[model samples]
Target chain A: MADQKDGNDRKTTVLEDLKGLKEVVKVKTQEQVEELKKPQETQLYRSIFRIKHDEEPRNRALSTLNNLFFHIHPAKVNRDATRYGYTWGLGGITFYLFIVLVFTGVMLMFYYHPTKVQAFRDILYLENDVPFGRLLRNMHRWAAHLMVMAVWLHMFRVFMSGSYKRPREFNWCVGVLLMVLTLLLSFTGYLLPDDQLGFWAVTVGTNMARATPLLGHQGPFGPQLGMTPYNDVRFALLGGSIVDANALLRAYIWHCIAIPLIASVFMGVHFWRVRKDGGISGPSPVMLESEAKN
Target chain B: MFGDWHQLWVIISTPDNIPIVAMLGLVPFFTWFAFHNMLANDRLIAQLEADPQLARTHHRTTYPYNSRWERELHTNPFLMRKELLAAIIITIILMVWALTLNAPLEEPANASVTMNPAKAPWYFLGLQEMLEYFDPWIAGVLVPTLIIIGLMAIPYIDANPLGNGYYTYHQRRHAVWTFLIGFEAIWLVLVCIGTFIRGPGFMWYWPTQTWDPDRVEFNVNRNLDQILGINGSWISHILPTAWRPEAAIIARALWGIIPMVVYGVLAALFIHWICKRSAYSRKIYSKMSIIQTVTMYIFLITMLFVPVTIFLRLVFRIKYIWETPWFSI
Candidate 1:
């Protein structure tokens, strides 16, 4: 009978030990779940962009490819290209300025009309009434001029580097085309304000346009081509003998809508080809050769 | 006043301009950063060779250890840094600039009252300055066309392959000289003259001279015709006939050829010098062949001609060095 009683006590102790072990396992699992939930707040953000902290380069490339914003750039760029010295960021700066122009230009349109009378008044209204209106006009004009200089400097840098060889030759032509477009856009915009500076400046500019050789009657050989005051490139451009209400309207549409669209297309081609052309010519053979000797 | 320079910055920093100022600030910062990076890299390269172990780890050597990644091969430290830096820096600059300076606004548009000097916008100041020297057609039409064409043709014509990536004076002397000279002589100098030197009458006024509406200078300019007393109507001056437009015109046209002959010879001799100095080699001459050589030389000389003609006008008041009914040479 004493032996039976000891057996009962040992069995009960074994059962109690099992209960304790189960409780410990349950508590540890609950603690792990809570710890995991702590990271979820940050994970919400990381998951939105599909970015991971420890992603290898493969994911970086995948991220770049999948994202619309990153498409303009390669998945990876050469460290050399990152150095501020090489291109002087002129090309990139020009692009940024263009973006600035687009943003501010749209703002100006809200208060502006292409008409001769309304154009100046609208500018005045923008300056006085609309919030931050004067700022937009100033930034737009400044950036327009700056973009012209920046593009030229970019071309100069490219020329100096001789990056315009072989594959880039066609792109160079496209660049020149873009420069012409930029000048035209600026020229047209110059007259839109219709101030003493704008009016007279456009007078000088359109008069030059009037002298386009094959296109205008005022130009040399224009008479032979049957270009006349009534029917010439200038007439088509201005819709009149000189810069009038019609001229303002024409410049307005071109400045606001037309040229920017054309520029956008060419710019797309320009940026796309930059990638195709091996992403900005790395230090070429001659550079390496010179370095080796040094 | 010198203080007027500061007035340009009295931008009336309203909320609207904050964006513009921010952008403007970024530009200078970006420029500074670039120069800083260049100097640092030079410093790095200077030390890398001294320590072979450092050089071994750096991509300064032909190979790098992280061969598994193509990015390691193509790229250096990183690129995303630059992209982000450029954006952030520009944003900051535009923000600051807009917060400080006011964009300029003048009176309403008046078609009736033209500004006295009636300047074109600054970009076209170069062309406007040229208009003073030549006929409207030549300065406005022909020159701009030629400039665009000439710029387009540079890559195709330039055969020197030695200076592809690196900017070196020794290897690419011809290209460097051509680009710098063209930029300085034609574009930059003319723009300066138009912007700073031109005054109310579209006349030459030094920067020290203020633009005064009351100032009236005389038209003391004497053309070649008047100086020589070669009145195209008065044949009695040099022609055998009495006062007749035809005889006087003939005599004047004949005299005009003299300068042409002088310039022609000068151009030829210069072309010869160019070919010889380039060692008569096709490789380093920027272009090959006699025709290409002659054309390039003439283009350079002609670019120089405008400035020289302007100089003669300012100093000697000489006009129509060579003249015809259609144009002047």
Candidate 2:
């Protein structure tokens, strides 16, 4: 009788233990659900974004100012500056095309080999074998061409708007350098395919280097200065007398690395100066000829 | 004629030539768009200038304005949105372009096989076209360098303060006309000529004419000195026998220099006359420093030289205006 009483007592204790455990689990799960419901309140989200994305003007301004990439832009811009008719967005388009070029160019670099024998074959293989390789190459080429056109138009627009006047003059000079770099970038990339078109085109191009005054073998007084096919500006440019394997490698490096680096530096200065020089040169209050300071 | 059209189509349809083809349309459209805005702004300026009361209260832009509205907008939503839209549109266009047209890849580069009428990439074709008129040193090297310098010099040389941040043809007439003539009439036109006109052997072919690789024309090019019958031997007549050879070179160089100097002086006088033509222009000209005026004259004269040389080449068949053993211009 005593043993049966002990067993009943033990059973009651076990049931009580199980119920206590279930209650604790239920409360903990509820807490977790409450936490997930307010994800914006989470530490991770707060750490990355820094500011809440609300409809407040402060947040809107912070969104541009705090971001790494978007910081290139000012928090607020002139209402007229946003108009499509004013800037035609050519400068921005040129920059966008440059970004496109860099992306596609990097992808292209994976398939290309800058050697005489393999260079042409690699392009062939890319066109035929690799997935979307032709698309990559086409995008790069077309974007490059588009970029050149855009740069020219940007300069044209700037000139027409008189945006290069006053304190903006230095920026204009930087812009001119950027334009030159853009052309150089395109010219260097042109020789990478190593096809007949590129070969002849580059040959014709580098041939002109042979006529660089005081540097080229065939230029005025170049011979008198000891310039020759073996050692002259053209030789220095191509790494030899002709556009061959070395020229291919040289062009590859310049197109991929050197000019891009230089261009990026110039572009940084150009943008910074634009802000320093008082934003996009207007569609501001037009100054009359009578108001002109003599 | 139909075959000629086909031939032209073949050239235009080539994948590499596509950019130049696009340029033909885009350049003219943008130019027209710019001029249209410029003229509208000019009319507005005229209206504003006529009435002081209206000028005092005017918003000064072509777009409609309201007093209640803010002068500025948040870049995040306004400018950024447009930029995003532009980026998306350009991406779509690029994607479509990539999908539809395959990038050109000709037979592997063969040094042994030269491309008939070998051309540089389309952008450099203007320089190549200039090669027909000037020596490689002048056309290929010097002109390109000068163009870069001239572009950089514009802001410094432009002393007129009338059209500081806006487009008004009347206010900045000289600047606008100079740029238009330099960019549209010369650079873009030369690019067109290089792309469409030059054919096999780099010879000029009318749009309707078929490119015949074997066609040859008589060479009628003559140097300026030769055209004037100023022989080196004739010039050597006044010098001792020992100094005769050197004197001939000196004489020829002097002859070349004379015409060049004459052209320069004439171009400068014309530019000066134009600058002083109007009362407003004179007011602006008076604002310029001596350095600015001279720099402007140099650039304007150099710019005019391109067309002058082109005319001489095409019409007069003159090869070299300034020719020496070392260099020819």
Candidate 3:
């Protein structure tokens, strides 16, 4: 009789445990379902508002932007468009244009100047004077600004996508170089006005140049490095041992012509390689989580 | 006017001065040589055509062999439309702008009088900024040399074919961020320090400390003048000290060995961290990291903002800030 009683209790306990396990499993599954459903929220907003409400006009605008000529990249590249945490995505094209600007810029420099006395006049001459002057200068300026915008967007896009991963490492390096070139191009071109702004900038800029190793002869390693002999490179660059009229002309030549040529060559290689390699990186998992629901 | 074979030594030694002598020396020699070569060619062609084996062989004429890709490329406008379009757009814009706005030309080149600020071309601003922060040896010479050499050696270093952009970052998580952050850091720091941190001498009109301007002036004149005497008063007199705060400390601590020490430490730390976290061998990490770091550094330098802002501000003279870290004067 006692053994039967104990057996009855044991059976009841087993039944209760089974019921508890079932409940737990149901809850866990429900939680996963909720997790899976979370991503659809943004899609709902996107479809309900941004896409649905203005679908026609927006789509048309996008189409225009994506056309072969005016547009820099696909209107909608990768969703990884704004991650500061990493770098990748739309940055490639920005670098490409920068290179293009540099190239055409150098060619344009066969006739350009950044001097108050001659800059504006030179522009007049280049346009009305040089055979293809007008077209070349405009293209260089436009491309430079466009490259700046592209590079900024590209950086933001990379940051958003979090594509700055292990394997795509060196391309990041290329991106950095492109960014520097963009700014340099802008800075040098700024002086072409030969206005007050141009004058001040060149003055500041040359001051900085003079700080160069062995050339500046002021830094820790300048004296130690034996950069004295190659001082002529600096002198020639400055157009004198000091920054004078020769310096201004030299800067003008370099800003307008010399460096642009070099930049163009490198830019070409960079872009060709970028296309040869591939387009932008796809979105990361974290980024996809928000999108996956839709 | 000309030397014969016997006097060839005199002609060779003073080659530049022997303008008439050169013509005299070459005229007869070339005249004789041309006849000999023309005659020799005739003999050789005759010998070849006369050969029994050549005569027996069927004479085959061949047209130029070109690939379909090449032939199609010649006619196909769409083949390189993107590049061509880019080029055209660039050309059109530059030409118009140049025509509308002519850049100034300063007075004909003179080296005596120095300008207030002297700068290199736009592309070189980053390097120019580097000269401001670190020793020019490191910034102007060594660092640039290393970057170029390193760039050339990229293919040999990172041989991994795993992620060429197809896979998501999750697949190659370690490599991506490492490249981005590391590159961004080096570039940002170098560019920022190069541009932003001009010596305090150039930053404000007066020293902040209670020290006498006269004493400071005397000291600067005594020590600084000697170092910078060669460039003279026109440019160097107005410029800031080449050294920055970090530079002085780094210079003193390492005795010219600081940069290398810093680079070594960072490299070792990076490799160790990567290895410990991923269980990947050091060899793999080193390869990926080298490409990753160099690439990042380049990218980071490209994004440098201080110099760009300074350049733009200087150009426009928009006095956005009345007082800046440097250039109060």
Can you list each candidate's DockQ?
Answer: 0.26, 0.74, 0.04
* Candidate 1 C-alpha lDDT tens digits along B254-317: 6778776787678668655654574423335644656656666667667767777888887997
The per-prediction tally of clashing pairs is 20, 0, 61
TM-score chain B for all models: 0.71, 0.96, 0.41
Q: Alpha carbon lDDT of residue B67, candidate 3?
A: 36
Q: Candidate 1 has what TM-score?
A: 0.78
Model 1, span A1-294: residue lDDT tens: 223324554544667667567666777788768877757346665677665534466666766765677767787776455656677787888889889999999888888988876888888888888998877877787678668777777777777666787678778888888888888888889888877777788788777766777777877678888988889877888889877899899999999899999999999999999889877865442332224321
Chain B TM-score of candidate number 1: 0.71
The 10-residue segment with the lowest total lDDT in model 2 chain B: B1-10
Task: Arrange candidates by DockQ, descending.
Answer: 2, 1, 3
True lDDT of residue B249, candidate 3: 34
Q: List the residue pairs that clash in candidate 2.
A: none
DockQ of the two-chain complex in candidate 1: 0.26
**lDDT tens digits, residues B32-111, model 2?**
98888888899889999999899999988888899999999999999998999999999999999999999988888889
Best by TM-score: 2
Q: Each candidate: what lDDT?
A: 0.69, 0.89, 0.45
Provide the lowest-lDDT 10-residue window in model 2 chain A: A1-10
TM-score of each: 0.78, 0.95, 0.41
